[model samples]
Target: MKKTAYLCITALILSFTLKPSTVNAAASPVQETAKTSNHTAGIKQEQPGTLEEPAASEKPAPSEKPAASEEPAPSEEPAPSEEPAPSEEPAPSEEPAPSEEPAPSEEPAPSEEPTAEIPVQLLGANAAEKTVTLKWDNVNNAEEYVVFFLKNKTWIEISRTQETTGTFSLAGYGTKNSFKICSYNSEQRQTGESSEIKVLIPAKIKKLQTTAYSKTKVKLNWKAAKGADSYYIYGKQDGKKYKLIKTVKKTDARLNIKDKKNYRFKIVPLFKSTLGTIAGTASETSYKNTEFVSMGHQKYTYSEMCSDIQSLCKKYSEYVSYETIGYSEKGRKIYDVILGDKEADHTILVVSTLHAREYIATVVCMKQLEYYLLNYNKTVDGKKLSDIFSNCNVHYIMMANPDGVIISQTNKARWKGNANGVNLNRNFPYAFKRDGSPKDGSYSGKKAASESETQAIVSLTKKLNKTQTLAVVSYHAMGQIVFGDYGGKNQKLRSDITNMYKIARNTTGYSSAANYGGTSNGNYREYLTYKMKVPSVTIEVGSVSCPVPKYQYASAFNRNKLLILREAAWLENNF
Candidate 1:
């Protein structure tokens, strides 16, 4: 019995040694659970917001299964330990994830696509209607357009439209209307913009001047306004509202009026565009039938001469003009009134007032100029005055010695020399002889051509002789005579002088005298006769004295007015 019991214990110990242990198999699961719990704790520390995913991952850990494949979302899910949390994503938070940093910013960043194109637009203004119109071509992908105007250099929205045209009131806007347009999408986001367009009102007219030719005719002229296509001239009678009388492209307009009615005028500059015509504002002025040149009843001063010259030139612009040949010693202009075509081949030079006291000559010459201008289109002696003088230009040196004339009229009634006390008649270059120092009367200058007056005359004569067939008529005072003989041997020249004297004799019934022999003191007629071979004569008018009285002017003008025409006619026919 003891031997059988020991054999059984050995058999039991051998069986225990042959079988696997149950404690290790049971402890394996517990060890794996502890490992998974530790891993889950580490994951929770890394990802604080993901508690559910960690617990779900821990439930499969005790089975010893791979938790990565058992996860509900493997490709869609983020491993928090390896990747950023949902808070770090750019979609949810301000801070962006590393890989998703450029996605949100780069996906919707096509704002520059709209700014690529700039549209060209048109702007029109109707100043009369007080409206401005903006028009432009349709832009691609543009749903609507916003019109904005500049206010203190900043653009402010004015209107919005789906079409390409818009209109706005221009009452508050000034002359310079600056505007721009912007295109927008359906969401009202700006896509593109147009260049600024300026709609400007035409500027008002200035320097309005009126000239009355006669009781029935008037002329209006003004300086050109900016952006003006034409000028609208309005006329009113006796305090009535202005009515549009004419639209003229030129800056000047003429009006034919009734004999005795007071009229007012205003000129509005008109700007034309494709939309409509607009008129600018203007100031008003009255009209009067006023004569420009005086009737010689008052003392005609230099100022009067300038005024008359300006008016006459403006009225008779077709046949009349003037230029300053030279200035006097007192800085007064020496006016030469031209009364014919400037391109004429022949010239008739009429000089007056060489002696200061001989002012009647200036008056007579001015009357003659006016007479010719008045009868310019009239038929006289088989031809119109304009036609007669078409080939011959009459140049009137109205007052050669303006300084001397001023002195004679203002200071001394008998002054003959210029302001320099030099006798201009004796200061010519042909037979100039310096007599002595300057005195009150008849004092030759220190040298030939010393005085500005003498130099002007000499220079003019020389210039005329170079290009034209020139004849000179010099008018002196208080002799009622004509100097016909220059003592030259040229037969044709003598004949021409004789002919000129005959014309003067028949016109005025004046006497003839041999004022210029071959040898003489310096004389203008002698200079023309000998040096230049030009036919010239000196006619002395007024029987009583120098500075012929105003009453004697009518007779002098009546006799001399026809003299100029006749002489011009003779030259045109003969020379």
Candidate 2:
């Protein structure tokens, strides 16, 4: 493998080159050519009424009565006192004189001061005010109560109120605060405090972050504070306390701060409380990175596909871009990875695995993407791949039906429909018909393009048509044939399908299906041709089983290497 790069150019001329990362990232090289790739579509607001108090902070209610024992039974009468003369303070433990001649039974000595049950709950979590309101059951004969706030870990009397509820300002208290209340006899401070109500306040935000763009501007972001209605952005200079800079309407605070070199930022959120506005703690930026991009996924799950494509766009942004072109039936993102020059005069759209059992097509699409990007600058047959990209935009729609792909992966069954059980391949608008009921594999969906996957394709093509989409190639598997027909509607195509068919046959050596066309109802290829006025072809990659054996991946790649280039090459010349 010495001079590998040097040999790569010649090796490309004689054979197709395959790389591991390219295969790993694209789909599963052979297993998931186009992998069957969850979505909950909601605003996801934090529902209210989830307020909670600490377990230790909870005060027991005053309704229950104390049990029988009144006092410690006088220590078993001091071991029955053998005639020893008692000391001056009565041995410091004996009950006074036992009443000189009075009997000890029924002394009627239950005169201990009544203790107050502390407050049950605190109000004002929703209060706009800075003070916390204390609430508890009222005790009879109690004239008033005193509230103590924890200060420097020491209890200090904060307020006294005649009513059952009283408000205590968090002001002058440290970040952590707790409170306790005691009932007063006619004079206050007559009894020990009821159980303490510990108040917990957040001290700081979790993760304040900053991302530096290429310019002098720094993009600031912070995790949203729970129950926050809005956030305040603060800035600091020269190590001083951060000053309030701007008030933002979202809990997820984001802004671009520019023209400053040595400075920092802090974020504080204003949470909603009916008692007024409850506030959360503040966050601040720790650091910033200008060149950090995340890694790709190991598996092409629906979410993994989105994250991986996003990573690619960040890392290879100059050559690659991505979009949520549409969604699957279950709302999973149908990500479309666009490569080559966007401003190119011609466009080629590639799709794979409309059939879930044939997800291997997705892998092919992914590997093709990886392979093309790596070799775009290298020459093949005296033509640089980069030069081809300069004139043609290639769009790779990996795993057109994510719902079916996932189902197939999990159960290892034959599923060729979306999560709704509609066959997306047969759900397009053209030649629409009821294929079956919702739970059947051949279900054509209730209406044409009813599935999100189909609609995404429709919407994508409509948008691309404005930019001159010349052709589309949807990859399927287990047939080993490349052909063009939309229910045999090729006669009405804008251009003859003969040349395109020939190109596919030449590159993959798959048999041409023009003479023996495989007809299907409400297919994507038909819709693309008839409605979009764009030539679309279906490449049935191999004649193997549903998954097409892992060893057969090389055959899949060898057959479809020039699939896009050939189509783009044709479009560049003929269009």
Candidate 3:
């Protein structure tokens, strides 16, 4: 059986050589596959095959016997092929399968940075300290920040930082500096830059000014400094160290400092930075000094009178009540300084300085306030001063014609008229002479009560009439005399009028200006007397020389200081 098998294998091997044109079976029964290869020339080639099957074109005919794709063993080696075997189809590229470990993920080409759209905030600029700080809120994925300076209306990059805050030295920033900011992401991609923030460093003080509101108060004013947050009101009085009086937030702010004329002020602008409860301060460059005008002694200016009276009222606030009855033609306020019991049913209205030259009488009224306040609630004539004043509100108009008083005080003229140049005393509506030309020195204006001062008096008298006012006293300078309602007979006078004359005579030995006429012409006295029936009297103080100097204030005040008190005390019996 072994010999027969060997003979069959030999016969098969010979059959392949003999039938070269026809296909023959190979020793192995496995099917032959086409070898696929590609050349650089892009051409396909294959080994020789049977006529029935073209080289690598179509599938070989199916046969039970396996085919030998190679030629039967040649005795000699064939010409060597410079190219490798051509494959019927190119082998699939050796691509690595999807890695479970992800093959290190090629380091995911670092992601791009986020856009920077953060807004910036400028905390403050302290020029004195030569520093400027800028800040902003952190942007998501922001890796860094860039700062830009606005130059010539263009934003130029100035610096970069990783933090949200940045600062610049102010030495290079001139009077004004503008800046902006932008943020960048980890990928170096940045968002649009923030809006510009400007820093203003004020210029040094060039001028400082002051206005004397009164003898006791002064206001300091000046132009606004460039970037000042607040002004430091400093004062340097005679022989005193500089002191900060107040801090004004506004540039046009006003405040009362020292009252004395010798006091000078220096305003320094200041700015502050608030970080939690802690704060930092920087003072702006300032070296200007200013002073207020003195009006009381050096010049009896109207402003001084207003301020002085205000101070006096403040000092004796408990007993004094001041109000602006009306405004003069020149807009000067007509003040009525009321003294005694405000709730008093029996009241007295004392008016002074109706004539410009008689301004000293105003001082008398002021002294009366001081004296009365001191004597108030005290024992007088063995009776409590409070009892005397409890039902008597003494309305003392310190200066009836403030405009006229200022004119006389400044120009030294007998300016008895108000700012409109009409005689305030002759401008009253009661018995007023409308026929008198304003050109006349003592002309009663074009009509009765034509002057604001007179109108104020008229309004006050009318208001008091309802309040049970007992008497109205008008004080004048240039004549030390007492005059009362001139209507009808002197014997028909009320007992209170007679008593007032006697008191005036006994106190100052002044003569009485007896009147035969039933009414005076264009005067406040007549308006209060026959017209209103309030029992008015005119007490002429000092000489007829027009102006009574302030020097005589003591003498005049002393003579009449007790006159009002005496009359007020006798009201219960007389009225």
Over 455-499, each residue of candidate 1 has an lDDT whose tens digit, in order, gives: 888888888888888899999887788887757789998899889
Candidates in descending lDDT order? 1, 2, 3
TM-score of 3: 0.48
Cα deviation of 437, candidate 1, in Å? 6.6
lDDT string for model 2 (305-327, tens) is 56556554543445788877876
Which regions in candidate 1 have their CA more than 4 angstroms from the true location? Answer: 1-145, 148-186, 189-215, 218-228, 236-243, 249-253, 258-266, 280-288, 295-298, 515-519
In candidate 3, what are the lDDT values of residues 428-530, reduced to their tens digit? 7776775544444467788888777788888987888887756877788757888853444445345556676676677666777874333357877766666
The window of 10 residues in a row where model 2 has the poorest summed lDDT is 47-56
Per-residue lDDT, model 1, residue 74, is 38
**Worst window of 10 by summed lDDT in candidate 1:** 17-26
Error of 2 at 202 (Å): 33
Better of 1 and 2 by TM-score: 1
Clashes of 3: 13
Higher-ranked by lDDT: 1 or 2: 1
Best of the candidates, TM-score:
1
